[model samples]
Target: MPNSLSARTWVIAATGLAPLTWGSTYAVTTEFLPPDRPLFTGLVRALPAGLVLLGIARTLPRGQWWWRSAVLGLLNIGAFFPLLFFAAYRLPGGVAAVLNAGAPLFAAVFALVLLAERVSARTLLAGFAGVLGVALVVLRGDAHLDLLGVLAGAAGTASMSAGTVMTKRWGRPPCTSVLTMSGWQLTAGGVFLLPVALLVEGAPPALDGRAITGYLYLALVNTALAYWLWLRGIGRLPATSVSFLGLLSPLSATLIGWVALGQALTPLQIAGMVVAFGSTIVGQAVAGRRSPVRSVPVAARGGTGVTNEPVNGR
Candidate 1:
């Protein structure tokens, strides 16, 4: 077994990778997938990938877990995915990303409402800063805004934020693994999309080799693998801390836009990135400071009886 320090380090690294992989979605969708049918693309990206993960896990959720999983899936994946794709297809990538940055702010509100979690001044400030950054990025030099796209993105972010808070509120059942929890959500989301995909998209498009590859990467790696890691991190870390880390998603998307897609960033966009990322870091730091410290029990370190440093100061 890895030591506590090593394990924590791995979790952070894995967390970072998840968002970075997510950042690639814009370029992948634009470059590879057939265009114009946003809902269809969302269906393909979610349902197939979800089924594969469910097969691998081979653990069906039981009792209350089923309902909980379904709710979470709808909010986090089913609704969020389709709306996100709609916004992405309709709006500029920078604008979409900026709108999605409202996730943290939504999360804060939902956390207070659902989980009764207190929001500190620091977190609130950070949330505002993040929103400002997003506005800066989206507004940029353009005078006109895509109202439909903005609404879609904001709705998607709200759905995801509610889901995140619900997950934290519900916590995980002792009998279920994070993989199983994730599988349930994916399966539910996929099932929800099946009819829509069939009706709206009709038959699957004739995919070229590159498109096929992109779909595979998105389904297997981005949805299944990344989601699994994310759930695990949520189990281990503070809810606010984990939510704050999501600010990186937009930042990563910005960088990926610049590097992979050869999209040029205006000065406003750069400023937005700094403010958004900086606020996230500050929020997490403040949240961490307020949380109580718990000593690491030696037995958790594989029974060596040598206590390791507390993970996340708890």
Candidate 2:
């Protein structure tokens, strides 16, 4: 119990930074990156960041890991980035963010189906509460939600959620650290995006100082550093619990708007923030409650040989 609590504490802190950094992406892209270049932006954010990590780690996928890495890369970074980029571009950033608030619910459902994880009703309620809270925080009566953007956001959430669950199930290779594993996924995702970015968006942006600064931050801190902690947290923590932390993305973005952009927050939005935070706390408690590990039968655990003399039942 003590060990689990200690681990959760650090995982929460590290994972929290990922969403906070991600919160800045919408603002940064609109302010500093080239306009209407979602594909190129996504590509730059993923591929270069990935290559840098690979250079640092100096590792390659081993045997079957090549395909495993590709699968994960496609789902988590390659496809996810493009889908998310489109959503952010087509809709208001807040609208895009509110749509993505469904990620934890998707994670919970996927874990339940694929991993045989038992999800509590409290977690489900928390997910619904999160959606409501995010709606309050991000949605406006005048906001026009785009259907394509909504679909893209839903698909992105689903992709990342499944990737998170699968990462937990597979863990990493023996003798490989989390950093190197991140390199494998990042590099694979970047490679996949290279041709697409060139075909769809042509040449890179004419990056001036502001654009350069923004790209550097995204590549280094948001992609490389953030994903390292996120993937590691998935490995150590419950998939649903980690997914719940994603709620902070919209919250941080809203807070940034309030402080940085001078966007006004009504009393309702403030109350919603409180509810959203409470939901995160409740969901984590429920998801983080440890279930006992199912022990392997003695025969499987290398007890005295019984296979040759298995006459009792058969």
Candidate 3:
């Protein structure tokens, strides 16, 4: 369905909420969750949340949806979630967020190759500015650079980027509700992580009150519910616009750090925020002017492949 004015407003508001919830993750991790068991925490976050959503949706995907959902789940949630937690464990919150900021650039690249979408020079330059802004915000006096952490963050970003492009390319089946579609991916991702969690983390660790609460919040609010809203927006909005909204995740984290965690922001961090926010605006404006690329008809390509289109805007 084309987005109505109210739908557009709702999606924009919902998009804002997803990132704000994401931002609290850093503070929650440090203050509440067990520090050494990042993978375990990720597993908990994905699995339980997935189960809950699946239960609510109570709809199994039909036909090839099973396979498609599984693939999307791995990229969007399974691999991305664990890798993101690993990055958080190894790096500072700001640093991890900064690295993740590269996701849009990665998305653009994947769109070009996988979806046959074209990238404008302006979008490419904006991508660089976004990365630079993230660098300015997170990299401090050379103290925060860790090669391993950076690599992990990059991997996580790539996973999510690939997922985003795939989502846009494939869209969703007509019979599926947004909730079911999201539930399928989350459940698939959770299932994928379960064995890994068992082998790696083994059993659950002793949890303090804070850790328990944090896990619940991450599972319920951040993973399950936030994902529903995000996917809903993604389905309705343009891909580029959806990707740009991701900037709010880091920006929200920065604010949460300052207000909730009392983490001090440097002057450079402030500057970085301005640039990052600016890049988002610039990207959106440029994207708005261009018409979406028409994908090869699904019939022309075997039903197995996806046709790429421009990201949806409300």
Lowest lDDT block of 10, candidate 3: 305-314
| Collision pairs in model 1 | none
If scored against the real structure, what TM-score would every candidate get? 0.85, 0.89, 0.86
lDDT per residue for candidate 1 within 1-314, as digits (tens), equals: 23644565565567667777887876787888777766766776777777777787788877787898899999989899888877876775357776777777788788677655677888888988987876666554554458898899899989988887787666665555677778888889888887877887788788899888888888888788888877776655556666777777777777887988887888888998889878877876675554432334434423222221224332
lDDT of each: 0.73, 0.78, 0.76
User: Any runs in candidate 2 off by more than 4 Å, and if so which?
Assistant: 291-314
Which wins on lDDT, candidate 1 or candidate 2?
2
Which wins on lDDT, candidate 1 or candidate 3? 3
Residue-level lDDT for 289 in candidate 2: 61
Clashing pairs in 3: 237-312, 238-311, 238-312, 238-313, 239-311, 239-312
Residue-wise C-alpha lDDT for candidate 3, range 158-203, written one tens digit per residue: 9998888787667776556677878899889988988888788888
Question: Which one wins on lDDT?
Answer: 2
List RMSD in Å for every model shown. 5.2, 6.4, 3.9
Top TM-score: which candidate number? 2
All candidates in order of lDDT, best leading: 2, 3, 1
* Model 1 ranges off by over 4 Å: 1-10, 292-314
